[model samples]
Target: MIGVDGQAMNRFQQKIELRDGEALFQVGGSVRDRLLGRTPADVDGVLLTPDPEGAGGRLTQAGLAPVVGRNGGRAWRGRGIDLTVWPREPGQPVEEALRHEALQRDFTLNALYSRWGIEEVIDPLGGQADLRRGIVRATGAGALVRDPVRVLRLARLASGLDFQVDPATLAWARAVDPGLAAGERVGREVLAWLTQSAAPGKGLDLWADSGAIRAIPEVAALQGVAQRADYHPEGDVWIHTGQVLDRAAQLGQGLERGALGVLMLSALFHDVGKAITTRWELGRWRAHGHEAVSRDLTQSRLKGWGLGNRVVGWTVRLVADHGRPMALARDGASLTGWWRLLDGHPCPELLFLLAQADSQGRVAAGEGEPSPPLFTAGMPFRAALDRWGQIPMLSGGHLLAAGVRPGPAVGRGLTLLRRAAFLGRWREGEPIAPLLRQAGLLAGRAKG
Candidate 1:
């Protein structure tokens, strides 16, 4: 069932010019995936041969712009294949060199290798056996500590490759400092786990077990935070958050790239504020103004990751308004309130999707999916959107034409006009009135 490339690999083997003792082996995910009956999108190879020009000189001469890492090894990334080559000892036997390279991989499953143009796999650490056993075992005792990124990588592989981590390896992973790895690398690993994994919640549970929680203390703080049993019969804030992420992964399959990234990040941080804002009141717990705090915390976290302003801005707004859809639909709000929800918004659909996921996350044990109204397409959130979208476009430009001076008053006047027009209380061309005086206009305002 291994679908390793044949003719193309044979051509590569002929071009690399292997000497008697030298070898070029396709290694890591490519070989492992091929054995698992999946066509790996990316192929990794290690050439146990040296050239006077450099480790990747053969490939570069064969048309690649390889980069040399700090370790003096060269990595050439091109098309679907990424190859790394390091200088090997003169007259070193291929078996010994391949065994040494295999021992250096982070996990035994990744330690598997296959020679170019050869069908047989050279498993130096019995990675093939571990692969069949569906286990991810460290190649060395110090592997996790040596590269703490492996802890997060385990988060990905847990669901990505559908395998379990060896208990001993998990123990070692839990002791390593996640900060030892680059933050950007950490972010990418986490994003992949949440976005690509079918069970992002379980992957994060593994992450927390591996001490990757040290990477984001905000999330770790959620572990024991309380929620009212009536509304959140499932469990604590952390458990609720996990459920939300898994629901979001299903809900977000329709989204892609920055949009999906925003949804996932919003879902992760949507309830973070509950850790600080939850209070005992009226005989139960309440997070009266958690969304605002969550919005702030989410902004800080996203900025710390050096995310772009557009993604950060949208995610922050979504976090801020996470409770709006259901609340507004049930109790209603000012036209300006709902307008502000979607104002300058790139995608309200994503916001609603995250909100739905948040709502779906909390449930009693053994209960089915939450009922619709909040979950449906004709959701009150949508009605409000339609109403707001139809607001008379008597914009700031129109007011300027009417000779109204530019300032806060002009904006306020416009909002009032829109609010009045939104409820059909005042016509678009009618004289503006005090919307605050209207009976329906002052029901309530959104919390900060």
Candidate 2:
């Protein structure tokens, strides 16, 4: 057992207690985080006791209700932390039980444990050494095969800690079929990879490298699609995806959890349609209508992952409009046009972020910077919109209030007024009767 100094245990005793001959130790990510000199978010522990009822009753008396876990252990959640405490069989020694549990874990670093109060760690598989060296080594050969979901766990740990997976363990992860993992387990890992990890792109690269990306066939299909060399000298669609994911990681820093997750997902699937629409037409590659295709595909995939309708709606909206900003800016379209596109959207800001990530990701080799006007021209419009705050649009009612009668001309007159407003030629609440007549909306007839 190893000892590490930590500060989270000050209220540990006040939170819970154990009966005689029962020992509880802080385990899993809590112990790993403390050993790395980082503060753990929560405390989770395993209790080694033959008397399961007594230990559960003690926790219940301490204001925690116990629920049965998959491993036949009692899980509890309360004011302080979440704990999954396993009971040792009859006549089992503390050392024997701890070692047995340690070996059953997925990774060596995660297998390390520490008792409450003093924080003494019990290492049975050189997990402490691996943690110090920043390596993710599995506990045993059968660990990942026994639970293929550990592949995602490995990816999460590697990305979260910025650690490298040991070669032997990585191979084992690669050999396992990721399809064996449950759907919800896969979805949770996907969320953590994007929302929880600082280097979310690394987690994706790990999935691709370890062959785990096959579990997400939609993403894997991006491996071979091609783009214009001058525009995207970054090899292929998959390579571009990694770069965009990394950029989203930078752009989404400190955002709210749901917003960050949505942005990352948008960046990931913003160009997924390119896989189907790319063709060598007009002497260069083009993915016409890729945004629409990507929007549909992204919706289907997120729904398949069992994401909430709100998340699906937000991500799909971002993907659908992610390409429009640059398209509008390149055509010299008014800022009002951009506003019209996102008028009723949930998160207008994420659209800008998604577009920025996509535009910045496609860089030609040897280029010192990626500033392609073809895609980056609209980035400035985002700041302009923010400063403009929500400008009121000239409605059809305003045109009708003028001399223009109910017809197609009313809609046309309304567009003209909005253009005039955007170009500083008109303002809201200004008299439009004279202007409508002067513009021939009333065929030059004076207003009655």
Judging by lDDT against the true structure, name the best candidate: 2
TM-score versus the correct structure, for each prediction:
0.80, 0.81
TM-score of 1: 0.80
Q: Cα miss at 97, model 1 (Å)?
A: 1.3
In order of listing, the candidates' clash counts read 0, 0
RMSD from true fold, candidate 1: 6.9
Clashing pairs in 2: none
Please give the CA lDDT of all the candidate structures.
0.75, 0.77
Candidate 2 lDDT (Cα, whole model)? Answer: 0.77
In Å, residue 319's CA in model 2 sits off its true spot by 1.3
Q: Which regions of candidate 1 fall more than 4 Å away from where they truly are? A: 1-22, 56-58, 61-63, 66-73, 116-119, 334-336, 367-378, 385-448
Q: Please report the candidate that would top TM-score against the real structure.
A: 2
